[model samples]
Target: MPLRVHDTRRREKVDFTTMNPGVVNMYVCGVTVYDLCHLGHARCYLAFDLIHRWLEKSGYDVNYVQNFTDIDDKIIIRANETGEDWRELVENNIATYYRDMDALNILRADKYPRCTEFVDDMISITADLIEKGNAYAADDGVYFSVESAPEKYGLLTGQNIDAVRSGAGGRVDGTGSGKRDHKDFALWKAAKPGEPTWESPWGPGRPGWHIECTAMSMDSFGEQFDIHGGGHDLLFPHHEAEIFQGECHTGCSPVVHHWLHNGFVNIDGEKMSKSLGNFWTISDILEKVDPYVLRLSLINAHYRSPIDMNEQLLKDAEKNHTRLMGVYKAALELMGINCPPLPEGDITSQVPLVKSLGLLEKMAQGFAIAMDDDFNSREACAKVLGALREMSRMLGILEGDDLGAYAQHCVEWLEDTAGSVLGVLPTREQTLVEPEEDPRRAEIAQQVEELISRRSSARTAKDWPAADAIREELTALGVVVTDTTEGPIWDLL
Candidate 1:
């Protein structure tokens, strides 16, 4: 089956078909660049990153674009409060955003068009809306008339135009705002003193928050694109307004083919907010948590499900990440590669992993099944952990000569799925810094393996003292060894 996602507009899981075959044009709503990014920001970006990776795995040429709302009321307000230049503040925050996301290994978007850079495109779109009678000029700015397209105004949110008008983000009816209706949203805001202003058809003012996206996406991908994604909070006024404004401009029904929204992140069993003092920024967490572990924790839940942030969340992610890393590192030490494992085969295991490779290939198929069904990342993560467990079990019993190719295949699966695609495995520099920090640990680990091999030979031949002596040497070197039903497992103390 082809990829299908929960379209917020359709409010159903529908197949994602590209207007052009094998080409997916996806746009995600990016950060507004006013302050440091929090865990909520990480959740949203990680969801789309997984989507981007899966599309590539499925052999599509995906042109992914995310935007930065560089010129916003929030940015302006923040700058005013801090007594800093708004453009400087925006530039600094954008740099900070990249620093936070890069640590989590979030893949960079193809284009991050700033709102300020595309003001002309926005003005052109607002003019088209006004020319079509879909918008009207007011003393404050040009407002998109809610009554302009009654049949299509609130389709994204499933509310009728009337209900929306009453609760249009607190714009009350008969208010002195000069709007045709309370739900009427602005396309162009009239310029204010000491604020960044753009030259628009109406006057010197900046574009409305909703108009910025519609103009950016429309100019980048024409009238329609494949996927539009953001947090669930965007479903109402922000996204709905985008649809109404875009469709009104081009007479197109839906500006985007599929709309995907991720659920929110709650901190410590409550909604995360600055007022609640529970806001956890990504930078603060990265100080203690491994970036790979952070990525794992985020992927543990389905993207559409709200994430409950707690100390245990990060702890469990750390444990799971360590376990997977142990398996990969152990498998590699057992087959011996110190970096991201490369098995000299296709990523999908088309050519077979000896016999174990075949099982891994089937596991890969199961991973795809989850991802294909609305990008069920939790299910896919389960498959990654399961494969590692089976590989570890297989590692214990197989003879060294026979284990070579089979282990390589299993390592390849781990590398392809959990390593490259999920972005969990540490890069070369990170792996080199793991404790012992010794380039000679690999040699020492190989020595341990040889000792273990000798002990096994002694046990097979019914020589107890030699086995005990080898075990004593391992212990003397600070290696902790324990016998499992499968075999003996060792950890460096």
Candidate 2:
């Protein structure tokens, strides 16, 4: 089966054929670093990260580029409010963004181009738009001529242009008042007092938010690329403007072949946005729950569907994640794999060596089928759980055994599929605690070890009731306790 993706431009799922076979050039619109990232930011990146991992697993060399709007109106405003330099503010947030995303295990983009790095390219593109009559310089700034590419505009959203034109009247910045039409958007904004400015052909100004992406992407990839992705909120003006400027520059019909947009993330049934005052930051949530649980809560839903994020959703994700991790650890341990205790448990034992040939192959097929059809992660996750269950049953027949070649192969495949590809499972190294990890986590580890020690003492004294109480307490804290000849082991739920 061929891999399929839902192209926002066509508004349907289509087979994904890279413009260049065996290589994927992907650009995902990234953070505008004025504040800490939120759930909405997490969802957008998680979806694209899933897609990037899947593509690489499928044997395509992927060159991924995600950008940062390091210089923006929001950054400036935030800097002024905090009495920090605008550049310093952006730098701080960029570092914090990396911290949050690293905790989630998202792979880093090949390049993270900041808007300030490509002002020269922005200037060149703006000049071409003016020469081609696609843009014009106003008293305050240069604005894109919406009528210049009338036929191509609004192609992605499919919204009525007339209605948009009417709705947009006076909704744009006051600077756009001088545009040829009310719907025309700014390409460059003349510097205001105390704001960052760069010398441009039009005047001393900064590039508009939308134009920054085209310049950055074109610098990294060529005129045409495989996939362009972002949140659906950018579908209208941000992305639509990219299409207009890119196509007008090179005479290419579509600057990017596929347009991928992840759906909105909500909090308590309302859209989660910083402006809405109901948004939750990724850092805050990470302190309360595991990052895997956070990732699961986001990916559990179809990427193109809205998910209402709440406490229950995260609790449910934690439960499912714990269950899968428990099974995964037990399956590994059953093959005589040894490790430190976690918060989950498992067991199956008693039989002779049997051929487990092609077990992994069977699971891979179903998984690929689900993921290929428009990257259906919900269905793909189902495939993963089903595979683990079958493997667990197979392990049930063996007692204190060293896994045979086929069983080891099955185990390796499961690890790669779950850990590397989906990024929902921890690698062996990750499962072990790092000495330099957060102090809070170290304290939690100490607390868990103390509980385990007391439980051990109770069992040695043969105090069954006290031992059971500690075990029950551990379970309530989302830890699964297991006992073997070596002693008691636990996993985090």
Candidate 3:
């Protein structure tokens, strides 16, 4: 199936077609660098990361650019409260952003243009808007004239512009600034007492939040790009303002081809908020949960569906991660391949594993179908985990070269699909490492082997009751025995 995506503006799933074939110029709205990233931020970025991976996997050279709002009201507030320089505060928070994203295994964008870097471009755009009669300068700053382009008002949010104009929905209001209409938003803010300032045609002041994205994205990818993605919360005033500014300034009707927005991350069935005591920073969550498990938990739901994050969700993710990795490690050991500390290099260079197993091929096909359908990672992840479970059950029955080759095929399939696309599996070395050695390892191994021997004998004699009793005893000892065509094999649970 061809790639299909849910376009936020059209409110429908359409075939994803880039302006230039085999190339995707994608821009994702990034975090404002004032504080550490939270779960909502993680969810947004992870959704894009999955898209990035799949795009590249499907043979598209994706030029992904994500910008940072380095200069913002929140940064200024945080700096003043902490008695730190605003620049220093922005730098520190950016560093923490990288640390958190790296922990989640999110791929970095090609360019991270800070809003401060594009101040000159922002001035030019704001000035052009004024010259073209799309914006007007006021005592406070320049503001976009929503009246000039009334049609673009509800392109993204689907609000009734007539109702908003009539003040029927309580949507229209004044900002108390020197602006003509309440629907009009600021293009630039006038200089304040101690806030950061830049020389602009409007005055010596910083750019507004919405204008920063417009300047940075256009500067990176020109007047038009393929995709613009952000959180659902940005679907309103933030993104709507971008549309008005970009199209009005450049005379380009659609600045972006496809608009994508990920759903919110709710905590325990409630919106995550500091006042509600449910807010969780990425660092705090990583401290308690494994990063791989956290990635699974975040992407387990469709990107357009709200994820209710709680202890139970995380525990379930951990269990799934454990089961998937357990089979993967066992397969590598059977193949006599010791996984190095890093990922196996260049999956494409390796020869495709022969499709001798029907289950493996079915998994590959099912995974592709799920991912093709609007990057349905939730379903894709389910297919991977379910297939691995089946492979684990088949591990013990075969022996010698057949077993070894089958194991090798399973490992390669996993590395190609789950590791490459989902980003859920860990490196080979991480899977093989144990946190601590069991103190009674030798005694337990011996006991398990003896019990397996008895169980094998009972089964050979057709004494099902004796074999079942011995199996229960093994379970009590934290051991699981799989009866294969060759014999019953046991492993520590």
Winner on TM-score (1 vs 3): 3
Off by over 4 Å in 3: 168-174, 336-356, 434-493
Q: Taking the tens digit of each residue's C-alpha lDDT, what string does model 3 give over 1-493?
A: 7999999999999999998999999999999999989999999999999999999999999999999899988999999999999999889999999999999999999999999999999999999999999999999899899999998989988998888878744444445688788788999999999888998877799899999999999998899999999999999999999999999998998999999999999999999999999999999998899999999998899999999999899999999988888889998888744432222323243322232366567778899889989999999998898788767876867666667777877888898888989888788887778655566656698888888898889988999999999999999998888977878766667
Clashes of each: 2, 12, 0
True-structure RMSD, every candidate? 6.7, 5.7, 6.7
State in Å the error of residue 28, model 3: 0.5
lDDT (0 to 1) per candidate: 0.84, 0.83, 0.88
Q: Best lDDT goes to which candidate? A: 3
> Candidate 3's error at 295, in angstroms?
0.6
Tens digit of per-residue lDDT, candidate 1, span 1-493:
7788888888899988999999999999998999999999999999999999989888999999999999888999999999999989999999999999998999898999999888988888888888999999998899998787888766777887666556576556556665777778888989889988977767798899999999888778999999999998998889989988988998887778999999999988999999999988999888888888889999989999999977899899888898888787776656633334334434445433344555666778888899999999999888888888778877876665556655656667787888777889875445545566455556588888888888889988989999899999998987777877888877776
Error of 2 at 60 (Å): 0.7
Q: For model 1, where is the 10-residue window of minimal lDDT? A: 336-345
Model 2 poorest ten-residue lDDT run: 341-350
Candidate 3 displacement at residue 55 in angstroms = 0.6
Q: What is the alpha-carbon lDDT of model 1 when measured against the actual structure?
A: 0.84
- In angstroms, the error of model 1 at 262 is 0.5
TM-score of each candidate?
0.84, 0.85, 0.85
